[model samples]
Target: MELDHLLRDAVRRLADAGIPSPRADAELLASWVLGLSRGELALKALTGLEVSGADAERISDLVAERCRRVPLQHLTGSAPFRSLELRVGPGVFIPRPETESVVEAVLGQLRRLGEEGIRRPRIVDLGTGSGAIAAAVAAEFPAAEVHAVELSAEAVAWARMNFEVLPDHAAQVTLHHGDLRRSPELLGELSGTFDVVVSNPPYIPADMVPTEVEVREHDPQMALYGGGEGGLELPFAVVAAAEELLRPGGWFIMEHAELQAGPIAEHCAAQPLLESVHTHRDLTGRDRATSAVLARAQRGDVAKWRA
Candidate 1:
């Protein structure tokens, strides 16, 4: 079959299946099968390339899975976040574009720390999931020390794989298997030492069910729900962990549902040890994250830590 015709047919099938961004997904699936970049595949489609029988069959199978509501990332075996492409599948939560803003918030604080002569900043990602935030920071700000903690053993396996396969910068990431709520204990002496602590913890409310077929059906439950009222339990615990892990004058940021902005910001602002509390909006302009700076140590506070 002509590549163009097959692509059009795939798009029609995917769109009819209620898949969002059908054309992009169709092109990406074909690119994966052909081992070509999407741009190169597009060029081939323009030149009347023919789909080889074997490759055509593979594309059809992948398209069938997509029609069944399998995540496109799971189909392709990778999801792009920031400058990194992370491995994701049945047991891991796929990184979403909205969470990139949370990474940016961390990077921004790291850059500020650099200006203040803190050259080798230490940072940790709580509930790292696929290690997307941790790996991105390591890859982008190579000078920063990166650490990640995941509670789910299944998700930790995927996080380990991604940290291992990435380049040397990302390979610097230290992956730990533990619950973020116990980060202070899990991190031990590293507690009270991080220059920035960040996370994209599971914050979906217990009563709320995601509407996307891919999310509702395919993503792991442990990576989805944050039990308790308003799903703030894990998020609140993460905030406490950030307080424990961050050094005086360090920064902290976390991603959550838009509706969480008020509660989270209020909670952070109320903390005597954290200041400059603020809520940040993602690309879509929704309240997507909250950030704050741990208060700088006082003369007496510094002496106490030394003791």
Candidate 2:
């Protein structure tokens, strides 16, 4: 069958199965089978290029899996976040575009710190998942020291794969297999010294079942739930970890569900060590992240916070 015709059939199958962005997914799967870029696929389709039977069969099988609600990224085994393409699979949470804005917030603060003459800012990503945020920061700002902590061994393995493949970009990213809350222990010497701390912790309420099948079934629960009935416990824990890790006046940013914006902002505002509490919206203009600056600690305050 011709490439365009095969793609049309795949799109219909995916759409009938309720897969969003059917045409795009079909094209991407086709490109994967043909080992061609989307542009090249388009050119092939435009010129009436015929797909070999073996390759067309492969595309059909992939489309079937996608139609069964398998995540597109899982099928492709990769997800793009900011400037980094991360390896993603069943054990790892796929990085979403919204989290890119969370990275942007961190980068903005890092840039300002550079302007203020802090050349080598210490940065950490709590619950780093695929190490997307840490790798992106290290890739973009070579001077910054980046660290990532993951609680799940499975997630850590996947993160390590990404770190290894992107050696130049992830060279500065130190991956720690431990809970973010134990920064004082896992990253003991760096406690109260990070210039920026960021995370995309699980914020989905336990009872709030995700509407999409891909998320509802495939993503790891440990990377989806934030604990407690409202799912804010882990996010708040991220806040406490940031307080422990960040230097006085350092920045902390985190991603959460859209409905979490107000509560998270309020939570940050109430913290004695955090100020400049604000909510940042993603490209869709929905509240996606919250940011705050650690209140500069006085001599006694630092000791107390550390304790």
Candidate 3:
């Protein structure tokens, strides 16, 4: 069959199967199959019409999987985030476009700090997932030391894989296997030393987990569920951890559910050691990330260590 015809048929199949953005998905899958960019696909459409042999078979299989609602990133084994191509697979949270805003917000905050003479800052990413935020930050601030922590062994392993693909500075990014609710021994080594602490911890309410097919079927529950009530348990723990981890005047940034802005701001307000609590919106103008500037240190705030 002609390549254009085959591609159109694939798109139609996906649409009939209830896949959103079928044409785009088909184009992306085709490009992946042909090892070409979308622009290249357009340029060589006439040539692509002749796809045969193993290439044809591979394209057909990938299309079938897409029709089944498997995420395209899972099929491609990569997801782009903030100019970086992150390796993603089973057992790791797929990087979402919405999360890109979280990274941008952090970068913006860091730039503002830089304007005030802050240089070569230290950063920590809690519940780092596939290390997307940590890697992106490390890449942007080459001189900054980036530490990423994940409680899931699968997530930690996946994060390490993604970290390896990063540039040299990102290769230097630290990955720790530990829980956010419980302090890690590694965090103790750099107590009160971080200039910025960022996290996109699990915030989805437990009751909502089973409702999202993409999340329930594909993503790990531990990376999505925030326990009963889903009312900022993990985010609060991360904030408390950041209070201990951040240096005086350091920053703490976190991405949460859009509806979480109010409670998160309230939580930060309650922390005597944190000030300047603020919420940032995503590209869609929905509040998605929160940040605060460290105000002062409390006495007897021993940085707890965990194995």
Q: How high is the CA lDDT of each candidate model?
A: 0.90, 0.89, 0.82
* Candidate 1 local lDDT, 132-217, one digit each (tens): 99988888898888999998898999988888876774447888898888888899999989999999999999899999989999
Cα lDDT tens digits for candidate 3, 209-242:
4554666899988888775465578888889888
Once all C-alphas are superposed, what RMSD does model 3 give against the true structure? 2.9
Taking the candidates one at a time, how many backbone clashes does each contain?
Answer: 0, 0, 1
User: Lowest lDDT 10-mer window, candidate 3?
Assistant: 298-307
Residues 233-264, candidate 2: write the lDDT tens digits. Answer: 99999999998888888898999998999899
Worst 10 residues of 2 by lDDT: 164-173
Off by over 4 Å in 2: 167-171, 305-307
Ranking by lDDT: 1, 2, 3
Candidate 1 vs candidate 2, TM-score winner: 2
Provide the TM-score for each candidate, comma-separated. 0.95, 0.96, 0.92
Superposed by TM-score, candidate 2 places the C-alpha of residue 139 at a distance from the truth, in angstroms, of 1.2
lDDT of 1: 0.90
